[model samples]
Target: MRRAVATVLASTLLFAAAGCGGDDSGSATDGGPDKFKVGAIPIVDVAPLHLGIAKGFFSEQGMEIEVVNTTGGAAAVPGVVSGDFTFAFGNVTSLIVAKSQNLPLKAVAEGNSSTGQDGKDFGGVVVPKDSPITSAKDLAGKQVAVNNLKNIGDTTVRASVRKAGGDPAGVKFVEMPFPDMPAAIANHRVDAAWIVEPFFTTAKNQGAKVIASNFVDAAPDLTVAVYFTSEKVLKEKADLVKRFTAAIEKSLQYATDHPDEARAVLSKYTKIDAGVAEKMTLPAWPQKVNTASVQTIADQMQADGLIKDKFDVAQVLP
Candidate 1:
C-alpha cells in the first residue's frame, strides 16, 4: 500500500436573490435554534470561521452553522442569492459587481484584508524560480494567470503592472485556479500566476518566486472578502443575523488573539498541511466590516470597467 499526499479544496455573487428561510420562532436575545447555511472556500481567509467553530463561538451564541465548500466566491454567490446559503464568503470585487448589476446583497461582516506591512507575504504574482520576469514590467507581452477575471486579480495585477512601469494593457490574463497555479507555472502554461496564501507558500516551496506583491501595491489594507446575505434574508432573519454577527465578531477576535490555534483549525477544516498552514501569511481578521475599505474595492471595479456605475457602499453594508 502506498500513501498519497493530500490536496486542499477551496463562491460568487448574483442578483435578484431569494430569502434563505430561517427559524422565525427562534429567540433573538438568547442563543436560539436559528441555523444558517454558509458557502465558503476552504482557504486561510476563512480561518476565523473554523476557529469560531472549534471554540464553540457560534454554538454559544445559539446558532448552528452549516458551511459548504465551493470553488470560489463566484460559485458561492449563486448559492447565497438563491437562498441555498444564508450567507457566503466572497471577495468584495464580486460582491460589488453583483451589486452594480442590482443584486440585493448586504455585507454583514468583514472576512479578510491584506496586510500593509512590508516584506510580509500576503499575495503576489509568482513566476518560475529561473524565469526572466523580474518586475511587473517584465510581465508586459506575457501571459498571467489569475483566479478570476474582471475581479480582484485582474484589477490589482493590472494596476501593479502599470505602477511598475509596465504596460498593463499589453498583458493578457487567463483564469486559473490557485491550486493548479504551481504546476501551470512550472509547465510554462502560464507566464505567471497570481495567488494567495497557503498556495502562495506552496508555490514558493515548489520553486516559484514572487515577482511583485501586486495586491498590496495596487490595493493596500483592502477588505478583500466579506460575509454577505441577500436582502430577503436580512429582512426576514434579522435576529439570526444579529446573533451570527456577534458570534463572528468574537470568532475574529479569537483568531486575532490566537494565530497558531486559528491555523490549526484551518488545517483541520480544510485538510491543508498543518506545517503549511503554520507558515502561510494569514489575512487580517477584522472585527467589523469597514465601509471605506469595501468602497475602495468598489471604486477600483468601476475604474477597471468591471462595474458600470458607482454605487454607495453603505447601501450594501448592514
Candidate 2:
C-alpha cells in the first residue's frame, strides 16, 4: 500500500485489459444470461468454483462465467476494481491490505479455510528431503519461498516461526510462484517454500518434508482467502452480485458434500495429477467467511510490518 504503488494501481485500472470472457455491459442489460468475468488462480482451493460451473450452479442462476487465471489474488485486485472482473478470489491478507489502502473491496463469500490441524492443513512449509532444517526455527537467516510477499504466505509463515520460538524477522522471504517452489527446493534454490496443495502434496510425493503448518499456526480454522468484488460492482449491479453470491454458497456446500468429486474436478482446469489430487488435503469450504480468523490475519499483518493501520475486517466482508 505504498503511495507510489497506489498511484500505479489507479492508472492501471483505467487501461486494464479485458481478458477472455463474455461482456457484462451488453449481455447483462440485454436480458440474456448475465455473464461474469471472474479472476482466480489455478489451484486446488478454487476447485469448488469449477465444480459449480460444471454442475450448472451458475447457469441455474441465469449466469455464464468466464474465469481468468491470475498468479494470486492480489494480482486480480485491479481487475475487480476496474470492472474487468465481476468477482475475484484472493487471500485474506491481500484483501485486508487492499482495504487498508482505502481500496473499495468487499468479500462476497468465503473462498477457502485451513483445516486447523497441525501438520495436516492444506497449506504449509516444505523442505527438501535431506535439508538440514528440522523445524520452523531452522528457517532463521535462510531463504524461504512464497507465492506472494506481504501477503498470507509470508504472514502465516512468520507466525509459524514465531510460535516455534524462532525469530520471525530473521527469516528471509523470496517471491516465487507456487508451482515453481518444489523445483526450487529440489535444486536447493531456496531453503524452504510455503505452499498449498496440490503442490504441497506433489512436493511430499517427491520426498519433501513438511516442516511447518503455517496456516494452522495463524489461527484456528482460518479463512485463508475469499471471493470478493469491488464496492462499485456491489452497488451498481446489486442483483448480479446477489445471484452470484447465491450460486457461490451452493457451490461451497456442494464441494463440501462431495469431496471426491471436488478432487476429481481439478483435472478440468489444473494440470494436477489425478494421484496427487486424490492424496492432497482439501480445505474447508464453509458458506460464511470466518471474520475472527480474518481479524487474526489483519493483526498478524500489522505485527509483521505489512500494514500500519488496524484494519477493520467488517469493511471488506459482505
Q: What is the TM-score of each candidate against the true structure?
A: 0.88, 0.94
lDDT of 2 at 276: 93
What clash pairs does model 1 have?
11-72, 11-73, 11-74, 11-76, 12-73, 12-74, 12-76, 12-77
> What is the number of backbone collisions in each predicted candidate, taken in the order shown?
8, 0
| Candidate 1 residue-wise lDDT, 119-149, digit = tens | 4756788899889888889888899998867
Candidate 2 deviant stretches above 4 angstroms: 1-27
* TM-score (C-alpha) between model 1 and the true structure: 0.88
RMSD of each: 7.0, 2.4
Evaluate residue 254 in candidate 2 and report its C-alpha lDDT on the 0 to 100 scale: 98
Q: What C-alpha lDDT, on a 0 to 100 scale, does residue 172 get in candidate 1?
A: 87
Kindly report which residue stretches of model 1 are placed more than 4 angstroms away from their true locations once superposed: 1-32
Q: Pick the candidate with the highest lDDT.
A: 2
lDDT of 1 at 214: 69
